[model samples]
Target chain A: MANGTVALEEKSFYEESTNKYSGILSWLLTTDHKRIGLLYLVTICAFFIVGVILGILMRLELIAPGPTIMEAQTYNTLFTLHGVIMIFLFIIPGLPAIFGNFFLPLQIGAKDVAFPRLNLLSWYIYVIGAILVLISLFLPGGPIDTGWTFYIPYSVRSTTNVSLAIFAAFVLGFSSILTGLNFITTVHRMRAPGMGWFRMPLFIWSIYSTAWIQIIATPVIGITILLVIMERAFGVGIFDPALGGDPILYQHLFWIYSHPAVYIMVLPAMGVVSEIIPTFARRTIFGYKAIAFSSLAIAFVGYLVWAHHMFTSGISDTARWIFSLLTFIVALPSGVKVFNWVATMYKGSIDPKPPFLWVMSFIVLFSIGGLTGLVLGSLATDIHLHDTYFVVAHFHYVMFGGTGTIFFGALFYWFPKMFGKMYSIKWANISVALFFIAFNMLYFPKFIMGYMGMPRRYFDYLPEFTNLQVISTVGSWLMGITMIIIFANLIYSVKKGKKSPENPWGGVTLEWHTASPPPLENFHEIPTVTHEPYDFSQLEEMKHESK
Target chain B: MNEDKQNKENHEHITPYSTYVLVWLALIALTSITVTVSGIDFGMVALAIAMLIAAVKSSLVINIFMHIKFDEPIFKVFLMVSLFTLVIIFVLTFFDLVNR
Candidate 1:
């Protein structure tokens, strides 16, 4: 390490890099990515708990037939809180902020993220957004129930805290944009010497693509939400139908960002799975370049297909047809990734570790989700499914089944690396299995109920749908219990589980080359990466041939 | 090694603040022209002109202030793909709007 002095200077530059902060002051003022990531991890876990409780309450009210828990407005607020917390707080930051922050610099063989201070700032902004939304709940008019999308006319006219909710959204979008900007710059400028563009890991590529989506698409939604806030606060008539403005225009603007926002949420999870599968499969990913390129393709095409959500929002037949076609086209890249994962698993030495099990389940559930997406992409079909439980089922299939599975899978994959501890494989498997079954039972019935013409957001439904709703409620409770078990297992591991090896899973990536939980600066000497990422064969060859 | 190379590339760079100013003035001029032209009765043509002017202004801002003009070619590709996708959304929605 002749350039050890350069490394030393860099280390002193980030003097507090490796050490765990002690006092409240250290925790508050730290700019370390690992600390910031831990901050997000704790915050989002709290939000997820809140959201799940809201979800449980919503389900309980629908358990019998009528208002069992609270009034209709209360129910509306409950679902709205559930939607806002789950989306903006829990899922959007699911992989990127938690795992990406923890691993991106290490994976790229760098000291820290491109802009570590900006990373800390993004977390603060996210917290501020949550506070804003929470404060809105206590305002003179109750919390907003415009269904997260906050479509105007309804949102503008309602006396609820529309301004606060939209402002919170504006702040959240900024947080997302800063993260994207950071990742994009980091990938571009901070890679090791020999790591070429295509040589980077698929997870990095996926986040890179997602970052672009965050940068470009987020601003549009920021402006859209700003206009909504203005309309609500100052009597501006941008999307107010009574003021010669088109409410539909607000829908148009909102979907422009919100549609791509879902892509932002899922793309990083897909990246995480791409990393998990090949490592566990003991094979180079089939069609690695295609999978990497497809990430960008998906993000690119994701932007074009926003109007598919609005097909029933009354644009026009021609627009609907065009959107339908574009939506189907967007499905191809995702399909490519799925096919490649399956192909990688074929005839390979697959390790059925818990992470791999979750990745396998992600492939299955994500397929169902992606296929159902095609159904909604169809104009004629969407006309029937829009705002129904079918739409709800589709989103859950993707977010819960697709991204949710990956979130857990990433936790398992990176847990040892992040905390220097190994979770119980037996319990992890049991809980994932329980979750998988409950998840399908819960959402699968929604598809049937929705196609049978049951609308979503209903406090009371037809008596015939009562059986399915009860079944869904049972499944929801089961999933909630499974989540509790999984969390307990992880917490138990952190406290008493065996200390993990630096490269416990035999992962060949740069991340495993560092100490468990990583050094504060992540690396001692900046690695001059000279091989393709995920080249497990090279590592295999380097090991002794004999036992 | 690439960092050193990049450092070399950037060191010779004259500050582009003048370029930024020039582009900003051009954007302002084009927007004013578009606002003035909107007063004429050209039906949908006015909308077309306004959007065109907007497109030009946005390109200038993206190119100069955003540093896309001096960025790596890969970033330009990413930007172009995003812009192309935005066009797809706008065109498809317009089709829906027209059909309505």
Candidate 2:
């Protein structure tokens, strides 16, 4: 406990990491990874709120058989904006930018990322891209109505602000690529001594794998978006079908980046679950190598399954079947991870805290998402269900249920470490309960509606679909309420919550070895790792020593 | 621990200027071969030959210019993995094109 007192004497990264600036300027200009993480945290939350409001509006507009609030064109623009903001601005960069930036160094026992300056520049580029998206919304031609995918000929021929929006996506891809490059370099060059590959935390493993996908796959989308912009602006004949370009080729390039980009979103969430489950279970992970290798497996296999998205898009039967097989194969690694997580929790000394509840929710929701993914991955069913609400329900269950829930779970899990304060466990649980119930209510109906042959992206629904649309709209309100409660609780807790201990969760990672909120240099002295990550004996020893 | 220290040590192997010139010449020669072979279009085989020559040229540039050959094995491993990913995308796309 003497080191705890000494750590208290050490200035936290929040207090002052640099003397050149003060207050807002200090945070704005800071190269400190933790501060930059806070910067991302604030920015993404703002974008998330915008996305949520847009989503709620879309749901409200769909509340009846006819248009409820807006015209079809307005509805189209709203969904496009909602999709663009949510996918590109919020979820894609959500975990890796916020938590990865803050904790990758701390978890690996390093002073800072290998390229701190590039890390800051990536954030700036993200903001610039966001600004361009904002500018596109208000230009002479309202917002883009081409959907977030900006699919071909329609995208090239659209009169809306498609050019700027695609360009925004291109710039955002650069931000993603740079962050991925930085993490890859940091992991490769900067692990603490004795922290062998296997000894590193599973969170590090997941982020490393996600980073590789970000680096390799993002460039394809970047170029694809650029080509779309060119086709729009300069009349380039690349992806425009009218100009003798193949529209399916655009789908190929788009999904090539985007399908793996799904892994980019969810893999880090998996990483978060990996960290949370072991900590809550108070045990070594059931199969460390299996879980770690599965991340690599998922990443490797994820790249091969992009064309599964195009099964019903007039792609050849051979490509369709091959991609369908690869899609199912990719699920095997995810299955491995899911099984390993369940096994890790079996017969262990379980602590069902707020974070653990979220992990449990993630397991259920992501399982539904992953299992239903097979139905859509199959060539026959996809032809039946493509562009239906079934596909919508599937991804929302996976992306929102898997990644979005874990994003909050990680926020709760790492709250104390990041902010040096403890949020109310009661409020946290209430929020999770509302979220779980409301989330299922919101998206589960889509599966049924989709099976009943209700098409997605429709401004108006048939009278038969009216009841489910109303239910889904009601669910959106509950989701909005849940968001309000969660954000208000955390923001209030930041100033008024109880002061947390250095290691609140009995977490055995190197991040827990540092001060809550961590110092400017992270470690007082870099601790040499002799035990494997998730070693419970060391955690117990540290607990006893602290006591 | 010793291996850790050894990995940390900056083993900067500087390539000679002559090596860069020779690699550049080889790249130019490969480019000319691709261009010349394109003129003589051996049906479908021409595309295959051009791609093969382009791959070899890129490997040389990556190995010597990017220092993949002089660097640790892990770099080469990652490079191969990335190339393999590209191969997967191309093969899958071609599956559709060829079949259709």
C-alpha RMSD of each candidate structure in angstroms: 3.7, 2.3
Q: Tens digits of per-residue lDDT for model 2 on A1-547? A: 1122224577899987654888998887889999999999999999999999999999999999786899999999999999999999999999999999999998888889999989999999999999999999999987999988898878877899898888999999999999999999999989888888999899999999999999999999988988887787788788766778889999999999999999999999999999999999998898999999999999888889998888888989888888899888999999999999999999989999999999999999999999999999988788889999999999999999999999999999999999999999999999999999999999999999998899989999889998998889999999999999999999998999999998888898888877887889888876677788888777666766445
Q: Provide the lDDT at A379 for model 1.
A: 78
* Per-residue error (Å), model 2, residue A206: 0.7
How much is the TM-score of the A chain of model 1?
Answer: 0.95
Give me the candidate number with maximum DockQ. 2
The whole-model C-alpha lDDT of candidate 2 against the native structure comes to: 0.91
lDDT of 1 by residue, A415-527 (tens): 89888889899999999899899998789999999999999998888899999999999998998999899999999999999988656776777787666666677777776
- In the order shown, the candidates' DockQ scores are 0.65, 0.81
Q: Give native contacts recovered, as a fraction, per prediction.
A: 0.93, 0.93
